[model samples]
Target: MHGQTTFLNWNKERIALERIKSLDPIAHGYMDTPYYVAYSGGKDSDVLRILFELSGVKYDLVHNHTTVDAPETVHYVRSIPGVIISKPEITMWDLIVKKRMPPTRIVRYCCTELKERGGQDRFVATGVRWAESVGRKAKRNSLEIISPRMKDKIVLNADNDESRRMFETCSLQGKRVLNPIIDWTDDDVWEFLRYYGCRSNPLYGCGFKRIGCIGCPMAQDHERLRVFGRYPQYRAIYIHAFNRMLAARRADGLPTDWQTEQQVFDWWVHSTRRRREVEDQIRLSEVAI
Candidate 1:
């Protein structure tokens, strides 16, 4: 019985190692080419970096600086060896001033400028998983050829249908994108991290679920509250932007339902109050240090 148990444990370990090796082989084969890893210093990216190291794949570690990233994220990226931080020519503040409003999911101008074009002219690698978001889930696991115009360079046309479509699109003029972890699940990511004893961003330990733009529209209200409380500078910027947006709307004679800068400030203040009230009721609240 003891022998059988030991054999089963060995087999499980072997299977795990093989699964990691498979990903390594795929990445190793792509070495000798210019590729950049779109690292965000999150759990997923941490696992991706480990896999790259284990596979001995040569690639650049690139982090796109939105200028509005969490300080913790910035610190984490800086700690990683050989990471190159790339910032947009025009910042989110500039975009907000020009557009006269904060970004919404329906109008995600941030993604195109801050993210999509951040790693242009290089084969980009991401730890995108289909299970993470509905849109990402639609993406395939292999390399997809995009237009050079879309990314500021023209690359070779490939035989795949996705590549063909990309060749036709003026936006993808000469770029190729690679997604190595497209099939991974949330649980798979945690399991891999546990197996490899990988290090994740400290923000996760502090109750941050997602790390992106400070005031991302996709973030929950609780997240916004946490950010507002934790990062005063970011909160001040958002409040200023909201005020400017309110003024623009009024000047343009647009709809009047928009929240003013003062209102936003009040909401942030009240959110903290509400949190305190809830915590007091439950007796589980710990003050922010």
Candidate 2:
């Protein structure tokens, strides 16, 4: 069944490629116009980069550095040829300090600062899929809006919900945004990677289910645990940030919940415990060997 599915998917992808190629002449007529590929050094973005290259389109590769990205992911991006890295003028640490708390799903200032605003191009491409996040699933395939502050400025918007929202916000300010890979699925992404021999961040090989910010709240418990155990320094930084948040809350005379500190600590400790379990399993296997 898996093989049959792969075959069907590949055929569909070839058809899609033909359609894209058919539109290439029109797209290339605007060669003088700038397009940016938002590269995250993740598997998805890697696949997108390959697609852009294969399409024979001219585009600048733009990587947004969140400042809290996993070391492996950062290294992977830098290793790519001709990749341009943009760091946010504001650091996550600064944002957390200013906001006095870590970003949650409800309040994600990180995406605005770290990902969206960091892109240098007016038209951006991203390897965003609807299957990845709920927010992404709701976004339009293509749209144009004015930059947030400048009424006359237009930017093409693409990518997923987060990218769309970023474009919309920029449009409100008078910027345009564009997303070319909004319709691709996870399977399509992996297939592209496999077909193109594209390289992805090592973090994925190290058992990270999703690669974004080190302590992204969107991650599952097991993913966070894997991060905590595999990257102790990062885990410590998160704990320190959480501790600071707790202290700041107290200083502000905010009511404390017993679960706040416990929850953060548990998240850290639970990963450590899982790591130990894995080590034990390995040792047991060694004994049998």
- Give Cα-based local distance difference scores for all models: 0.65, 0.64
**TM-score, structure 1 vs. true:** 0.68
- Tell me the lDDT of candidate 1: 0.65
The RMSD (Cα, Å) of candidate 1 is: 10.0
Error of 1 at 108 (Å): 1.0
Runs of candidate 1 with Cα error greater than 4 angstroms are 1-33, 148-172, 245-259, 263-289
Q: Which lDDT tens digits does candidate 1 get at residues 1-289?
A: 0212222233433433343343332353532344577898888888678766655556778888888888888998999998888888988877776677667655778888786665554567677667777875444544465554454334322335565344334343345565666666677677667666666788889977777778776566677767777888877887787787678778888776546687755654455456657878677435432
Best by TM-score: 2
lDDT score at residue 33, model 1, on the 0-100 scale: 49
